[model samples]
Target: MFAKTLSASHQHGKRLSEPRIRQLGSLVTWLCLSFCSERLEICDFWNPFRNFVNLEHLELFADWGRPRKLVPFSAPEYGLTQLRTLKLRGYLPMEFVQWLLNEPAHVEELQLCVLDFPGIHCGGHGEPEQFFEAIPPHMRDQVVMDAIEDRRRLRGLARFADYQDKAIAPRSLACLSFDTIRRFKKLNKLYLYKPAAGRDHDDLEVYFSVSSEFRILLEWRDLILATRNTLEYIIFDQRPVCDLRESDDQAEIVCEVSHGDSYKRFVDIVLPTLIQGETFPALRMIRLFGFEPYEDDPCKEGPQEFELLGESENVPALLQAAFPEAKITNHIGRPIFIHKKWGELYGGGDVLNDTAGLLTIGEMIMY
Candidate 1:
């Protein structure tokens, strides 16, 4: 045997028996399962794969088209100690995320697409509500008293302290406890795929407040701060803020925050906080997709090619100054310059193929 890599995708109705999986455990060093469907019974069979102690890289992709219940797989007495990278896609259970963060694999590179935040309230929610039962009796009582006293605040070291012992579905994206995130002590490279635009955003808006998106950015800021000492490379994949257009004489940069006024508030009010405390010495690179050069006018686009815009011009500058030691690039990995004046010389899309190396949400899931 001794296979170096084993890859499978879109196995809609396939099943591998326990003995077969155990056989492959001794053979394969890397495994990828993609587009797993409801018929796969992943949660029920996940533990068997833990026997693959030599597995170094594991990639799992679930069918996002069909939302299914993902139960937490019980933690094994031993872990895949040699595993170094874990990539997951589609809906993942909160408890499962907790199990992973509990140092089961000690992965250094982690990629996630979407995390399912189950509703905490009991009753008909399509799935069984055993999340509350996962908490210990003592913690359950304390959680109730804290809720009664309105002491479940999202700040300081006490942030997410209640959720530390057990997992509870956060009501909103902003409320996702950091205790689960802070456990990624060995995380060095993180690639967080932003929920795609259109249907995804629309669904999120219906489920959560529009402001929750902006608030999640604040949450991400704190996440970065918490992991600043170890995290080296991070990428936030998102949609472009503006479309770059050019005519013969001049270029037009049209920018808009599609999520509306809250994102602007986040930019004005919260982003500066990223630079307030100690510098992130370990951060080597930060790539933010969707947000590029700052544009003054959103409505009309034209050759105001050389105009002087005031405080707004320093927007990109602030991000640059914040991470003095890191190289900040756009989606195409081209270095973004801090604009001193409004219509200063733009980088002019240095990469010939602007979309090169850019991975769409679909591409990310498939690959």
Candidate 2:
């Protein structure tokens, strides 16, 4: 039955007059057009589809597989009333992002690849700020801005600091990822890459000063207070600072101190506070990476067994004891232990290794 409809549509296109063609174009489910050169006069072909009231998906390609100037295609007439997804491949203008945000009621998912601006140099001319301001307030939370290897273009994003202080500032955003931390009000999830260590203090100070709505993930924890209480997941990626010199290395060896002491301070002081009942009432998961075990000190230990310092095998057990009803799964290359309640709730696992063990327990809870 579906095949016949397609066949009829193809036949109709062949026999239809130009006026009829315009009518049929308005009902197209999908449209793909290519221009040989940026100057190609192809406005008529686009006009019909621009009025399409039911376009669910759209893809527009230009330059005929070569680098050429492209023109902006207006979508207001396309009746994006029912459009669910929109994808643009090359040279998307700033106006495109604005258009998607304006039609918040119809678009559920939007992917924009600003292929022309590989370095994302739009910030130099104030385009980045202008682009962000054009985003509809209601849709800011759902937008994801992705750039590739373009740090210099984003350096000036701190300019938004002034706008953030306004009374009618935008606050519906639930997720945001940018090259810098300037102004964020209701962010819940964030992903940042390769941040400069020198800028760490300022970045953290900005976030910590604001109230966290839910979760935050970043490379450093310098500003996280033991009392913030709202964070659920914390991940740290420790890479040595670029400015360290031979003299700095020599001092560290003389003092017999590891350079990672600052990170340890955060874990020791902040981590324990989260597991306590008074903080993070909904805390469920805790993950620590690149962790080194505590070295034996004359004052600290007996026969070397897996202890809490470097080998955190016992950390999960301590947390389970504190939150008796919580599910605790220690991720240390294997499934260490599961409390009886969690075991029954998630499905019992062998003390050693059980692949499907946790799933069974989760299913029981749902039923």
Candidate 3:
């Protein structure tokens, strides 16, 4: 189940109570709450989970993929011993951690990514340690990588060298993505996304800064060393920083990062780096999440939209030679942008039932 809240007032269990929760107890297996906050209290707090007897997966987040809070869990009330997978982000209550580890749950594997530095730039409590200290020893290795930044990005490469000394010793492949060859010995999947900018990134300035051309190359090199021995898939989420309008037919302009060296860099530098390394023995596929920009002329009489073209032809060869034993997928992102007949915009989903030929450009805004 997915639940999002504008504020912390949504009583997730209000609709489900005591005996009623038991109705779907056998059927309910997963529960996920991604929100900005979590306020724990008596009464209806655990009401929804009372009869979640078979719940095997539970993911609780704070501040929208931030971290989960460490609120005490007084009782399971009816003995919820079936939990198997627990993923916690943000702050977590120490008392509950012990309960999850001690009782029938004995959750062995944990998934978590935390950022608790005053300089983290994220809106919540920036001090990361406060959240981690609340976690018990049984859950330490479960901590995934959380990127380290010194105000600006790229130029901040020097910081990764000292990461081993930091508490919680972040070692997840995804968290330390920005700094390559940082030492996630068992890392398999790596992602390098040009964060889509807009309201969702209001604090972007404080998080990262522009990197020099050489610095970008260095970033690629870091990726090479890090993935040399372990990577299996490389997913690149390419989105331009320029605030461009959502695609709305001919009038709406497509803000494609593929228009620049981003794609070329991946082809010319990043890909080549994969083969040059001694590792990457497990490397298989490289996926690029972007598409080339094209023009539309509906008034001139033609197809409704652009062709469903994927990555350029030559990329497959480059990836294949690097990992002659693994399969390669040049999965390209679709250029279809959501534009409502009314003047509204959206990110995902096929472009339909709306103005499909207009295009515009402005700051990238997302709800």
Candidate 4:
């Protein structure tokens, strides 16, 4: 009872004794594991974790040895029934995340970095029958399978993957998969990491196509619609859709979401269109990083080099109807302009410093 939190780092290339793990699982309320090497088997912790009945916060991060495949959690119910916050980094398998959400872990806040989703393969893009079947019947009508037609038109494009050419479906579903979240009745805060476009300044327009971007947008809409009764806050980290404009004198990045792969477009166009004037009464706040904050007084600020979209005054009717009472904050400039990865990871450099102080790797807090 005295040791309420435990943080362990495996750097010496030795397997942690199973007895010690089982012992600590019963004693610790917070558990953080940092595996420094790939030699330690990760599967060893699955059963031991069942003993962590008091654990409310679980953080697992590693620089290497992300699991290739995760066997189902053998128990009928998860030991982490009281889990409130779960953070997983290092490219966790989507199936594992699906399994956790499907079970009885009523996590309120989830932060995942570089989760494994299917790429443009046979199942998601070429033959999407399985993907469609996975969607719950109640929500199935909302999803529109337009990736097929889009891939058909751009068959000859050298950059795009020819999903039609693939012989069989990949092991994982390629489409935006959020059906499991329907089981999470109390989930309120979701934090996800998405790579920004236009990292290479030379090729500005080679990112996601309009159709692909729209599909992702629809997925977000469905997620909100499903959880509209309880979910309140949502934050998207490292999300950027911008272009690099270069001239003889200078070069700079400008953020745009009119028809591109940006969250701004999701708020401005997609949500408004899909909601059809419906309002998310429970939704209170939405935050997006890698974009400038909405400035109320345009005259107060001087001429800017980079163009930023999603001004509050531009489209009031759609914005007002869709969110109605929520506060939307778009902060930080385009991802390409940001210097530190943490700045993009959090909202800005200042917020990054603040977050680091509060949530370190091994620090513990008593609720």
Candidate 5:
């Protein structure tokens, strides 16, 4: 086949059918696959995809109706070494996720579909540690850190005049629920496609529950530690699911807390984790897209303004770590956290361009 790009969309119960089968050379470099089903029998032309050894992009979506699925139980790995960007949508199993995290993939940029993990935390259900341990061995020992002794400890130990690989341990991770960050050592950019495809951000709390939601966030917070050296940018991109009303609380925690409410809890945990100064030194920018956590419902007309999660003793360092330029802004493209003594922590009006682009919804182009 002389094809250069392949895009396939399969509705429920449909086999991933092709119009006419043809042999393609290494010239085919892009493959976009979307799917939906509950039946477990999702078959596609795996051999043809394999022959396209030059395939550099794979955008996959397996939209199973439920959080859990019983898809083709043992889908063998398709070896495609040249793949550079991997984007996943729809429901996924833990096994398939582990396969994506395989080290040899060497994906420079990744867009992860936010999905619920195996959250079985209750009496007789099993302990959280056991729940995590039950995952495959390759995805083990990834407890993220609160704070580390030093950056030297984060990198592997030394042997002789060079470095030592006693083991390439993910020792300094921020100990969040998600451990997949351990494999993306060389990743330059990571975009979290959020709770569900397009406009289902609220389903995160619904499907995963509030406590598990926080755990997911904790992992997201710790992700900085693993990629502090290589990771450059992060975007929390979410779209609205409804215009009726926002959640009663953006997130309400039943567990114990230093801060009383949900927003405060977030401020207490997430803010501190990223602002530690000693971590994510290589991070140039962290971007927040979509609505403010406490904003009023429905899309607005005359510009948007976000409330500032203002001052604490740590605010200065937070500014230093993330704002080092004028990247921080409110929804209306206004500066919320302005720096005076901390130097120019943001890019001034140029940050407004990003806000404009992101607000365009479906039109926002991905590079």
Candidate 6:
């Protein structure tokens, strides 16, 4: 049978039209809803989909209207007994995380892209023990929770600190980002995006200094020491900027970028003593994006190779020398050098320069 997609919207006081709920109620497979309305209670519209017995995928998008107590009975109920994926977007409460961890054992992937929450700040120093505690022990190992664009919300949790002190296993997780993996003691595979710009330089340094965010890099390093390790891949979608120095008494702002070769000076001067050897050992595959082209002669040459920031043949070579068995792939706009594991994938044509380019990376990824 073909999969079904359903969307619903309501104005202030009107109930969801009967036809809308009926269309979703009859679906036996996948269900997706992008709903926004000030008048309709989200629970009222969601109640019908809970009856589906054959749902394999379910997605919901909603906004914060009122605080609904997390109840055991009101969760989405797919009928097929084969639901494996759930994706939710909006200002999800901590209770939503609890519901996902409480979901049936068959669900394998749970993605939460929270655009806004009451108190969370992106890349902040807030403990998420209460949030993590909601995850049941058995379900913890089987679930992969992805939190995109999450900010830390660290205001009034002193009373909850005692519950957050316990440790949990990390192997159950597959892909996690932001602060989710920072507090996680054991993570198997991690995907890191570039940090957003416009953060205070001093605040950035202080946070990274204390948080476990850099520890993931260290853990990957340690995997190289032990032959038996869990980490298989470390994918950096964008380069991370570590040093942001503002000119004193001058209007100049200087930011230092860190990656493979370009970051050697920063690493030697600052990171060696701060970060240990095992920070990035277990990495077998490194995928880099958003690169600048390399110029052969600084005085006269145009551009030769498209070199990814912090990721060059030299850096990959260093990693290979240390690991000896890992495969390093550098993806640039076009092909450059030949390595045992290097291959180039062409990006969309120069239509990007045109006022109206037909292709974009976001569109491509969605397509």
Which predicted model would earn the best TM-score?
A: 4
> Residue-wise lDDT of candidate 2 within 129-239, one digit each (tens)?
434353435433422222221122245443365323211100111122232122222212111111111111221221110111111111122122321333333333221
What tens digits encode model 1's per-residue C-alpha lDDT throughout 170-280? Answer: 122233355656655676777754321211121112111222233345456656666677777777654212212233111122123323333343454346555677666
By TM-score rank, best first, the candidates go 4, 1, 5, 3, 6, 2
* Residue ranges of candidate 3 with Cα displaced over 4 Å: 1-32, 37-183, 196-209, 212-224, 241-256, 264-269, 291-314, 334-367
Q: How much is the lDDT of residue 108 in candidate 6?
A: 39
| TM-score of each predicted structure versus truth | 0.54, 0.29, 0.38, 0.57, 0.51, 0.37
Separately for all candidates shown, the number of backbone clashes (residues 3 or more apart, or on different chains) is 0, 8, 39, 0, 16, 24
What's the CA RMSD for each of the models? 13.7, 17.6, 14.2, 8.9, 15.9, 14.3
lDDT of 4 by residue, 1-367 (tens): 1111221323224445556756866777787764332343333334345557667777765332324333344443644567778776543344444544454337777765432222332222453565455443543343354344335534534344643332111111113355555656776766544443433334323323333343444455556566666766765554443332334111223234321335444454345542475555566666555433445423226776545433533333444356757766554433322222111122222322222112232221110
> Which prediction has more favorable lDDT, 2 or 6?
6
Instruction: Please write out the lDDT profile of model 5 over residues 16-117, one tens digit for every residue.
Output: 335332234366778786544433333332223435556677766553222232323333455456767776543445455454454333766666543432
Give the alpha-carbon lDDT of every model: 0.44, 0.31, 0.37, 0.44, 0.38, 0.33
Per-residue lDDT for 1-367 in model 3, tens only? Answer: 2221111224444443434445666678888765343243322222344455677777654331223432224546444466656554433343343343333323323343222321222312232463345333443233212222422222434356443222111111122233224533454544443322111113111122111222333354565565466665555444332222333332212232344434544454455566664666666655544423323323224543433223443555666676687765443333322122211113311221111221111111110
Which segments of model 6 are wrong by more than 4 Å? 1-12, 16-23, 26-28, 32-53, 59-81, 86-90, 104-367
Residue 263 lDDT in model 3? 50
True lDDT of residue 300, candidate 1: 40
For model 1 the local lDDT of residue 104 reads 32
Clashes of 3: 39
For model 2, the run of ten residues with the poorest summed lDDT = 206-215
Candidate 6 lDDT over residue span 248-351, tens digit each: 21111111122332233223322332234544545455444322222322311444233323443344445455556665543322111111111110111121
- Which of candidates 2 and 3 is the stronger one according to TM-score? 3
lDDT preference between candidates 4 and 5, better one: 4
Model 5 off-target regions past 4 Å? 1-28, 38-54, 66-70, 73-80, 117-124, 130-180, 196-208, 238-266, 290-322, 329-367
